[model samples]
Target: MKYECARVLRGHDGPVFAVRFNEKGTYCMSCGSDRTIRLWNPHREGTDGPTSALMIKTYKGLHGYEIRDVAIENDNSKFVSCGRDKAVFQWDVASGKTIRKFEGHVSSVNAVTYNDDCSVLATASYDSTVRLWDVRARNSFVPIQTLDDFTDSVTSVLVTDHEIVASCVDGFVRTYDLRAGLLTEDNLHHPVTSLAMTSDLNCIVASTTKGHIRLFESKSGVELNAY
Candidate 1:
């Protein structure tokens, strides 16, 4: 298959840092250093094919700093944001409202993710910790648990049904089993900047700052290949 750039989404005055689509892929939200999150319609009718995106809405004034990452909840009605502001924000997609603000990180929030149930949110920060938040607990900004075992800043985090996988600036990926309280670390030996699990949950991939990507088995954390 061949692909090409369909649009140059312009709006944010600064570099756009994060972009994501809802479950239905009907809408996409993008954020940047300008602190504004813009929504677009990639599938807008009459575009013919890959063309300029249809701008829908712009969300701003909620964050004091650059928005690092945005995550869509499982239900697609809401989304979350985290970034240099060192806080997490839950926003309503339709009304563009800040449903809640979660705070506590002492440094820039680098990445954020929601669990399958949307009941919990896991946040990674430059403070070298991955914090967990209970989303529905009204104004309860306190983190339920702070995983601070990493010696370096956490760059990315992904939560599964039973474990929390975090990639760090220390050139390694760590998996924490929530039920067994067991910790396992796999040494990529190259600063891991981002990570994600395959849809089948059988494999994972880590991307380093040097432009190298490594693959691994999600279960044993064994090195598979690199490219």
Candidate 2:
């Protein structure tokens, strides 16, 4: 397949930790070690072929430290970001305003993902736990369920149909059932840098700093391929 560079997003002073586009794919959002969140147009009109994206807005001062990961809600109205601030913040996409702050993780949050309807959100943290929160519920920021089977920090998390899979720094990927509770664990034997599941919920792909890219059966730890 042929590939080409489309757009370059700039403006953060420090290393960018995460970048994601909304479900509509019209705008892209980025966060970084500079402790700022920026939203920009990924497909701006009347731009030259190699032009940089037009930054729509820049948000600072809310997060105390670097922002690691960002997830745009399915509806395209808001998005969530988590990072070294040890918390998660939901922001209004149009107004660039903070809608809600979910503060509970004692350690830096490594990742965040939302459910199908955006009614639920899941977060992984350096505290070695995975927490699930009700997106629309307020006044109680406590996680509805806490999955803490990992012995080390949880590096990333993916929320599937009815399950939650978390990648751990200790070389394991643990899967939990929202109904059945903890289900199984896959031994990567090397720190798992990230975790992702196929949209059809048939495959799981994981990457590690050791230069390993692996694919597995989503429901089971059965290996399919690796590089």
Candidate 3:
């Protein structure tokens, strides 16, 4: 695939820690070290003159410290964000009101995701654990499973129908079976930075702090290739 730099949206005064394209792929939400979450219309039309590449919509005041991560729900109606303030807030995308605030992680929450069915939400934190929340239940937040062997903080977490994968600062990618609570495998030689699952669910793409992106088989924990 050939790509070109269309536009550069320059607004955040600090490094952008995370960016998530909405499910519809029209808008993009970004969080950064500047302690702000800004929405941008990446698809906005451009003029012949030099105009701003992206339009900022809502600057929500949900996080008090540097925003680390943000995740949109499967329905695209609401989103969740966490930051260095040791708090997680669920916000309505339309009204920008904080619908819920989950407080548990002693440090910053680094990652968040909604389950396939949109029933359960998962969050990873600098406290070195992942917490699950029942979205339908009233203010229900709890740590369903804790993988506590990492020597450093858990940087990211990915959940599929069959398994949960967590990347830690200690250069380990640990996969856990959702049903048995067993550690399936630990692969990768560098600290994992991000994770993406293939469409068919047969492979996982993991990016590392050492500037390498690796692919692994979903079941056997085999390293397929790296780029």
lDDT of 1 by residue, 133-162 (tens): 998888686999999999899999999889
Question: What is candidate 3's CA lDDT for residue 49?
Answer: 30
Query: Candidates' TM-scores?
Result: 0.93, 0.93, 0.90
Which residue pairs in model 1 clash with each other? none
Give lDDT tens digits, candidate 3, residues 87-194. Answer: 888888888888888877888888888778767777888888888877888655665556666677888888788677878887888787878977865658788887
Global lDDT of each candidate: 0.88, 0.86, 0.79
Tens digit of lDDT per residue, candidate 2, span 11-38? 8898998888777788778999999888
Q: Which ten residues in a row have the lowest lDDT in candidate 1?
A: 43-52
Give the candidate number with the greatest lDDT.
1
The lDDT of model 2 is: 0.86
- Tell me model 3's lDDT, rounded to 2 decimals: 0.79
Clashes of each: 0, 0, 0
- What TM-score does structure 1 among the candidates reach? 0.93
